[model samples]
Target chain A: MNHKEETIRVVNLETGYNSKKGATVITRGINASLYSGELTCLLGPNGAGKSTLLKTLTAFLSPIKGEIFIEQKPLREYSDAELSKVIGVVLTEKLSLNNMSVEELVGMGRSPYTGFWGRMNENDRMIVDESITLVGIENLKGRMIQTLSDGERQKVMIAKALAQETPIIFLDEPTAFLDYPSKVEIMQLLQRLAREKGKTVFLSTHDLELALQIADKVWLLDKPHGVTIGTPEDLALNDDMSRYFYREGVEFDRESGLFKISHKLDQAVRLIGEGARYNMVKKALARQGIDVVDADDCDVEIETTDNCYIMNGKEVPSIEMLLDMLNLYCK
Target chain B: MNRKTTMLLMLLLCLSIMAFLILNLLLGTVKIPVKDVIDILLGNDVDNRIWTNIVMKSRLPQSLTAAMAGAGLAVSGLLMQTVFRNPLAGPSVLGISSGASLGVACVVLLSGSIGGVALSKLGVIGEVTITLSAIIGSLIIMGLIAFVAQKVKGNVTLLIMGVMIGYIANAIIGVLKFFSAEEDIRAYVIWGLGSFSRVSGGQTTVFIVLMLILLPIAFFLIKTLNLLLLGDSYARNLGLSIKRARLLVIGCSGVLVAVVTAYCGPIVFLGLAVPHICRGLFHTSNHATILPASLLGGASLALLCNLIARLPGFEGALPVNSVTALVGAPVVMWVLFNKRKNEI
Candidate 1:
């Protein structure tokens, strides 16, 4: 792992919007320092001020009261053009551009570095190419933005931000609309970028499980607790995850580092077989309010092999027969 | 689009513009040959004095006005659409032109009550007053929109507010028409019909020169417009001052529409439709391509319409609005229809 360097430091920052009625502060008096070579996930439930914090950090919204330093320089002291070189941002809003190819869109990231006419030179083109390859989106470079799937479009946007050549990147819900595999891939890509390029990759997302899996550091935020920064394992072990995310029927599983629904199992079943089939049966029964217990004395016992399931001592050909026997006997 | 394809398309558009401009000069009510038109353009004395005077004084200025008005309106439309991120957005759609019309209606319809003199009786001075009032009315509305834009976050809300303002302006114009005398109403109606021929000689020179200065300035906004297409959040995060960019673009577009409407009386459809034609033709939304393409496309379309308006059968009496609307509407429809298959 590369040696870490502090990139962004926040001291007693209050973040939110100023409305017509009054100052509406979302998170207040927060202090945190984001480091290079770290993938920090800003995890929070909806309306937990994650976006507000991000907007404030990126200087889109003014900090209500406090100091934010980028590269140890006060953020407010840097002009917009200067700040743009220090921090790049990938917003959640869909680009309304049409007939523009991915390469053209990504090239727009060089706006701050370009001259008054905003023309791209050889070095800018090289940076754009490097960014496109960094995001592994070279194939989509020539494709129109409108033709891209949601996942592809998200990658293109990340490439655009990468092309900005900033040391720090802020993304708001980068995986919001992607499919399962795409979500995992995007999270992994961000983590890899942070580690390999020594970039501070800060992103806000609702994908708690994925973030826990890949995030080097997690910023747990909620309405009550402004923000708690730590490693995912540390937060889990310290019970801060449960404190912020736990509800009536939802429980945080420390073993798996995931949140699972905690519902009462009405009946217990014994599964005698092992491996994937047994686990599959156990999961299916668990969803139907049946618990798979290791106790050997249970009345209902399910044994699985390959594609076959046996109920008690009778062999059942498929999972349907096993489910039928359980429904008949468990009641 | 690649550089070659874009360059080729621009070349084609320029050729079309030249062809249409020459056609506009040659194919008017008076049957002037191509040879005479060229000679007059080259500053050589022509065989006939009437032909010389007609080509140099009247047709030349009228064609130049149409070209400038067309280019200015098209560029304004492109700016408005990009700023609002709406395909339907145009200079007229923002009520700026209706504001201009309302100003003219006030001067022409309520002349006797306001100044104790009819506008028709004032002659040359009355024309100047009418143009000034039109510019002032449109500027007031533009200022109001700019103020609202500073406070509002969403572009859609601003667009809807602009449409409502247009409706309110038209309603006031209707009320003014209801109370006006028949002759006054007729004069206002004629102005509302729109014309490129109204600007002639020295006035045409001033109009074209002003547009020449303004249109190139609009091109300087190409970078800003491209950034705007990324939408507000990205634009802001990319170091754009959203409010300042919005105000500058809106102010530029508003002034363009105001000046064009002041002179040509709210020549509709061309401003609303020419940008779409350029987009469809180039298949790209990059302002670098769209801006110049729209200028050439607008000028060509305007010249074509002007040619049809001055056909021998119409006796140079047809309103340019009728020609523009009749031609521009179908082109807009076709572009929209084609855009459904592709993306904007």
Candidate 2:
């Protein structure tokens, strides 16, 4: 797995839809390769064709131009049945399921391997149970799908994909409706699946920082710039993140490898701190248009301690008070 | 529920079907004793020749027709609900029943205009023609709807299309009725009222044979229906061809409804409600269980309704359509109320 195996290679792909009127291309001239044992993420602004790209790659939609290859074969060559044996997908569509247990829903993932009756054998049942365990949703096995929370449902769908035993998995906005913590959990789970299972996992998500932090490789699908593919650090170091998301008040913070809202702090203040709390105070001051500087002759000075902030000769217990004290003393 | 419990429920349903079939045979105008009815059914010659003729010709065929038609309608209903993914979908809801009525209406009017005689006078040949015409009529409508279904998405939209088409079919039927002679109109009205008693003698054999062939084929679709319950995209990703599955399910459901309507006159509510009742009873939507449950549950319920229709003191048997709606509506409402917008 560490030898860098390419599972999906797209050459000059153009993705969109066609109707009676004609074909409308969404994104074009995209060349990329997704590797096994790597969690690849596709990130873009809305309508940047992330879903379209996933659809085309998954063979749900025919590409307008260019070719996609799964392993060494062309995508068009694989029949729907063959593709099902190789790839599993979790879509963004809302499930309207009723009266089906979580275990049964996961069991349906073995459809490609089941006979006409779809009655699972012992091995299929074991695989289904293993998938539930793998997704860490053993507790939800007996629960009805209708009763599951959004996060639990998402996990069960992932378990279903796992039960399919496909090498490649594609998910569309898997973290879209989840809370912040659940979003992180789903992302980390996908990363772990890629690492431990050596499966090629590709997903499109709007969780930017989470993807930047956890993805093995990232595809930035900006509107003007086609697609920028690299590791997260490479994109941040090359200033691709900044250029792709070019806008006032938003700048990529290279030190954290995350984006931040940059403030043009014309006024400067001397700050004393050296750790986590210090950076928090610095970011807070920057948001208020005040810059932390090294100059000694400052109208106001805020120094961080274990439990208090010594700001403008007054002891403030919290950052909120420090802001208020600065308002009183400096403004 | 587990398999043993579901099997127990199925066994109970089968027992109920047998009990109701006996009840239907024993309780009638003649009021034959249970012993006598059993003796007659065991192929023994009874002392009362008149009793033998009545049981063999009337009650036996009616009971069998009621049970088979009920099973057919229920299976078709389950299929309609699955393919449309709506709680309210059925042959009746989807206008296929109206198409059957339209087919019969056209046949009745044509026979009336050409022969200058009522449809009742045409006898066995007439019944066969009506059955064939009704099947053709409903199947044609079902084919149209299936074609439209390919173009349309959304449950409510397809339902709305179904309801609209039903209204159009009813309108055409209304025009046909206007041209029909008085006796033809009366015969048409009686057929529309729906009856288990209408199918008797050799006509009963044809209806039963048709259902026997059609209903078993529906079981093969349990896998397809289960996959469809996951919705279109998920089912497709699992290697199902949605268009083919939809067409097959609708066609199967359509033929079942067509035959039942041709034989029983658009038996209402059994097709739509039996699946819901089965889902409620089994507490699962897996079609492997629900289809069989629907089959047996449908037979029991229809027999119960048939028994109720011909109960003591009434002048004649009640229209099965009226009894089915009366009994089925509440069962549906109760299930819906308990389940609260949950679908089959």
Candidate 2 on B122-221: residue-level lDDT in tens? Answer: 8888888888888888988988899888898666787789889999999999888787788888888888899988876888998899888999999888
Least accurate 10 contiguous residues by lDDT in model 1 chain A: A322-331
Instruction: Give each prediction's DockQ, rounded to 2 decimals.
Output: 0.60, 0.59
Off by over 4 Å in 1: A305-307, B338-343
- In terms of lDDT, the poorest run of 10 residues in model 2 chain A is A322-331
- For model 2, report DockQ: 0.59
Instruction: Give lDDT: candidate 1, residue A24.
Output: 88
Q: Tell me the tens digit of each residue's lDDT in model 1 across A1-331.
A: 7999999999999988887798888898789999999999999989999999999999888988999999999999988778878898988887767888899999999998888778999999999999999999999988988889889999998998898999999999999999999999999999989999999999999998899989999999888888999999999999999999989989999998889888678889888889988988888887788889989889887888776888888988877777888788757
lDDT per residue (tens digit) for residues B46-92 in model 1? 87999999988888898889998999999999999999998889999
The numbered model that scores best in TM-score is: 2
Which clashing pairs does model 1 show?
A: none
